[model samples]
Target: MRTTRSSTSRSACLPSLLLRGGLTAVGAAAVVGMAAAPALAAGSTTVGPAGDYFSASLSNSATLTVGSVTVTCSVSQSAPSQPLGTNSANQVPTANSNPAGPVTSTINAPTFTNCRTNMPLVNAQVTTSGTWGISAQHGSPSTVSFQIPQGGLEVQTSGLASCHAVTAPDGPASVAGDWTNGNPASTLVFAGDTVPVEVTGGFGCPTAATQGSFSATYQVRNVSTPSSPINITA
Candidate 1:
């Protein structure tokens, strides 16, 4: 975000006028200076890999309200450390480029709140595998955009005997905000957003239906921070 400068200006003679009346021109100059000052500093912000090796983790949490039931979901993911290049000789970072290799992420044990009593599902677990990418932008404070490719949100659920695991179709999911370089903390936080996820399992209770299909917009989040650069032999 940038702040615009005020176009208001005072006449140069006004300072001389004030000084002639036994009053100092300091107050008048101060007023003019304040009005002319820009509301915000100007600079380019960018974010990307600081070194050859990069690693980060993302954490997500959200609440789902189905009919009258509300369930809370929490997920934690760890991305494999990726090499920007073989060595510093070719480790030059580019603006708006993908990582050197496909970065795989593992979803940790996910937990839900008030799921058993409110919904037909007994327990839910996300798939262990997922993919991520970083899009770097050029500027003074460089920014990096994070994204999880489509079809990356794989989920498995366990419930009544008739219920079975189902996978959500691939769709593009991304962090709500960009991560800027030179932040105090290494970790970057993302806001929550809704993602459409498909599931195949038994619906209802007692006479549970088998092979049922359902689509829901579930809330998800990504919170990860890159690790410091590590030197590698070319």
Candidate 2:
């Protein structure tokens, strides 16, 4: 799936050698701004910079043994709070900032037919061909996979270098994958259903370096029961 994606890029180029405190400085600046922003109950995940000769691997029940992939994701529930501007004719009360006030949930039901066509990697990976030459930068491609099962629905997510808060990001996008295990003759059994995932933006990692380490959670939803929740305490 060679679909167009949106990602912010910079022209600053660093030497091939390890950056001495360069990344640390950049992260410190971004985190300062993030802390001043409001907070929410939801969380996110992000991966840091890896070496050029690195890997982007996505796995599951029946793994894809051929092509390579790496996916990134960030999940947050903090809504931006824009203060009342001075241009307003009347004075307004100071907006109350509440990180634990309430959360609004948006729900949807997608198909789960257990067919290959029904489920494919999210952040679709398109094969781009070019000469393996130096002087030009190479892009790290990845795939996001979510899983669904007959027992319940599971959302599995993954991300690459930019999945981190202090790097390039494509916001968030969601896709569903239909998963099935076993034969199709008579005793066909479904394992899980999942798809590509695009979550919210921001630093999902919480570390002592950044006040605390990042914590995140994964959930499962079903018709017969409430979603099974995983508390992502980073």
Candidate 3:
């Protein structure tokens, strides 16, 4: 009981650029900076068929403040668009689409149920089903978040990615193994501020396949001013 992909739909590709921010304490000054690598574009500017490209798509970036330092940055990411859902397998003469494959859920148990089987006392065996559906569409980067340790946090995304070639998560499927978009998450730590805890997650599908919709969200939290925030960038 899985879904299929459509021909009119776009084939998908996933690429991700993950960043982490950490804070350290100085006397009384606040410092902020992008984690590890300096702020730079990391994903596909334009996705093409294996060896092709279309246009330049850039991610959105923002800044926040704790005491004095201001970190400035920009993100550029993109994922391919997906197509209409697929037809049931073996139902030939339908149409043509990429074999939607091994898209997995973040959780091993990702379904809702309503029956404890055999015990039919006050209720019947059923599930008040609500699927945590996923799709980091084409030219979409599943989940992309940006943060300046001492500064603030912002997000720019199209979607998360799945292992397209695996072909399991979505049935009648092929596997699109390990594309990098559908699963979305990001964080920032100032100078060493460890109090104002901040975190986010893509609780549902960490990896996504083709045929679904852009149905993912991003989150941000600022525990306390990033401790000893230092200015890594402007």
- The numbered model that scores best in lDDT is 1
lDDT of each: 0.25, 0.15, 0.17
lDDT digits (tens) for residues 164-215 of candidate 3? 1111112211111012321121221122221121222232111332221111
Off by over 4 Å in 2: 1-66, 69-168, 179-234
lDDT of 3: 0.17
How far out, in Å, is residue 225 in model 3? 46
TM-scores vs. true structure, each candidate: 0.41, 0.15, 0.16
Question: Over all chains combined, what TM-score does candidate 3 have?
Answer: 0.16
Decide which is better by lDDT, 1 or 3.
Answer: 1
User: Candidates sorted by TM-score, descending order?
Assistant: 1, 3, 2
113-159 in candidate 1: lDDT tens per residue? Answer: 22221344344333322333333333332222334344443433344
Which has the greatest TM-score? Answer: 1
Error of 1 at 31 (Å): 46
Query: 161-206 in candidate 2: lDDT tens per residue?
Result: 1121111112111221211211111011112211222222233211
Clashes of 2: 26
C-alpha lDDT (0 to 100) for residue 92 of candidate 2: 13
